[model samples]
Target: MTMTMTKLPRDLVEEILSRVPVKSIRAVRSTCKNWNLITKYERFANKHIDKATASERDKEFLVIAGDYLFSLNLNETHSRKFDLSINHRGISIAREHSDRTVFIAQAFLSQGLLLCVWRNVIDNRSRLLVWNPYWGKNKWIECPMTYCLYEWFAFGYDKSSGRHKILRFSSNNGDRYMEIYDLSSDSWRTLDAASDINTIKYMESGLSLKGNTYWYAIDYEKEDFNISLSSVKEEKLAVLFSPRDRFVIDIWVTNKTDPDAVSWSYFFKVETTQHLSGFLFENFLIDEEKKVIVIFDIYGGANNAYTISGETGHFRKVDLRQSPYKRPYRLVGCYIPSSVQI
Candidate 1:
């Protein structure tokens, strides 16, 4: 008996296509011209994102492991060490640069696409490329200048223009310069990013949430706050400020994030009992609904995610890394699958 999808409504067909894995996107598109047209819409990407989240797809991290680009599923066992594979020419543009000296220094994922910066150690040169791992689509961008050591890269979309953009900024010599590369226009424009007075010198763990970029940083003139840069999502602000002394821990949140004026509402406070190092805050998430803070153990290399309860002040470590990782990997960020084109 032969099956037919011709009778199904377009919405039904879309729902089915959204359920299909992003890895098989090529095959799905080739199966039917209608399917190709449906998948091209932005709404279909949104539907696919919803389907993935609803299905409990393990949160993935797109990592640059030495010369290889690997995906590590944070929630699964064994796969944390990476069972997934990548064999695409787009990846090769960054992974296997003809110069040989050039290597993928950093990567950021937005809407199922990856913005990669290929660094050449010998010449101190950089190459920027926007790549879709799922579709094997690659767009190379000319780097106006070499990305310095302190300069960081972030990938986000412009809501108004509906274009994917890359932001590269660094606060070097007490001054900051921000440059944005627009994927649609294929151009680079500099933004008068910051002044010396408000410049952030020590910044790390930059995260892009809801088209706005946030980072965890330290000011030499001010105090430091321990917060989860990874667990940031939503319109409301959520933060974990467990000072270095670690006597009392608390969660503060607010509805407004206005630069001029904003106030934080007290969420919960947890008294300290167990000894958790500063590294625990490296890659963390605030379980707002559950009132728990999950911290990825990067220091121990034990492949554990430390989940701590706010009320009980108790925590448990779940081992996610199955094998010993030899190469030191710099975190790009949470890898979210998107059907959106680059």
Candidate 2:
């Protein structure tokens, strides 16, 4: 009753391993010579590398608080934190310029670049900074304004033009303006659009996906806000309406619930009560490979986080107060390809 490696086709085994998470595949590589050879194949390696990168992006959420930034690794029982504090030189410049600092402004991440904006204290100007934290390289561009400076802003990439655009709306004038920065040209130009008849309110927590930026908005009625999604590439807008009206919209990334498929479901909360809604819904990171969404909620002065499933919608809460390190406010998290890491 001896088992043979030839019993299973090599292609079949490769397919199975490709579907597994990269961590599991790494463990299997050491199991035997045949497994190691199969896992090390260039084709298999590239496929698994992409899968791992996408899984990380879908699973991790960058938490930005005050001066400190950290990455929250939610896969383990306790979350891991990585500090991203700028050096004294960078910190002093960031504090003096105001616009160079990364704050709670509209943030967009793509390729290896993170685009963010802050205010300039010396000139009272708004500036956009493009930086690659992974490589410690950054470039700053000043934004030109006509009247009052924008209180809220968003950063997005326009795929069609192959450039980045900054969308800012002024609360005082109820005007929304767009500035297109051609990364290749290193120039900026303003966009002309009809006035927004309705008062335009901006939400800081917007999600940028597929060259489009989506933000939560409250109508002039001062009631519940609706989800407003816009594409910088197309320069168009579309409204995504949820079933309930009183819900606070936060974006979640999950492949299990396809938007076009009949099984489409969104993970969010309807504010049933003031304090209770905050307790039930927590900001989380989605683990696509594990098929789980990890949520961290600081309630009752206790930092409790959990991971939920996209398919089953099951919840499990883990306490993190006992952990030595606490989650920082400003943190950067990214999923780099194994090839890139090497």
Model 2 stretches with alpha carbons more than 4 Å out: 1-60, 76-104, 120-125, 145-149, 174-176, 195-201, 219-275, 279-282, 298-304, 309-342
RMSD of 2: 10.4
lDDT of 1 by residue, 1-342 (tens): 665787788999898898886546667888888888888787987887677655535344555545556554423224222122222211234455565587776666566677777777886767787887665678888776634556677777877776888887655565567888888788889997563324442344355555555554456566755655443333454666767766556777765665455467777887767555445564555545546666556665554556667666665665545433434444555556666676
Residue-level lDDT for 151 in candidate 2: 52
Instruction: Give the clash count for each candidate.
Output: 0, 10
User: lDDT for model 1, on a 0 to 1 scale?
Assistant: 0.61
Please provide, for model 2 over 1-342, each residue's C-alpha lDDT reduced to its tens digit, 9 standing for 90 to 100: 775654678888887777676435546777888888887767886776667565543233344444333345545333332211222111211323334343435455554456665654444466677664333346777666655545555555666664655555543465555556666577777768654524445434445544444444455555443333322112222223322434333433333312232122444432222222434231444444454445446655556665554454445656655544443223232423232110
Clashes of 1: 0
Candidate whose TM-score is highest: 1
Q: Which stretches of candidate 1 lie over 4 Å from their true place?
A: 1-13, 20-46, 50-94, 97-113, 132-136, 146-149, 170-176, 192-194, 197-203, 221-228, 234-237, 247-249, 258-263, 278-280, 300-303, 323-339
Candidate number of the best lDDT: 1
Q: Report how far off residue 331 is in candidate 1 (Å).
A: 5.4
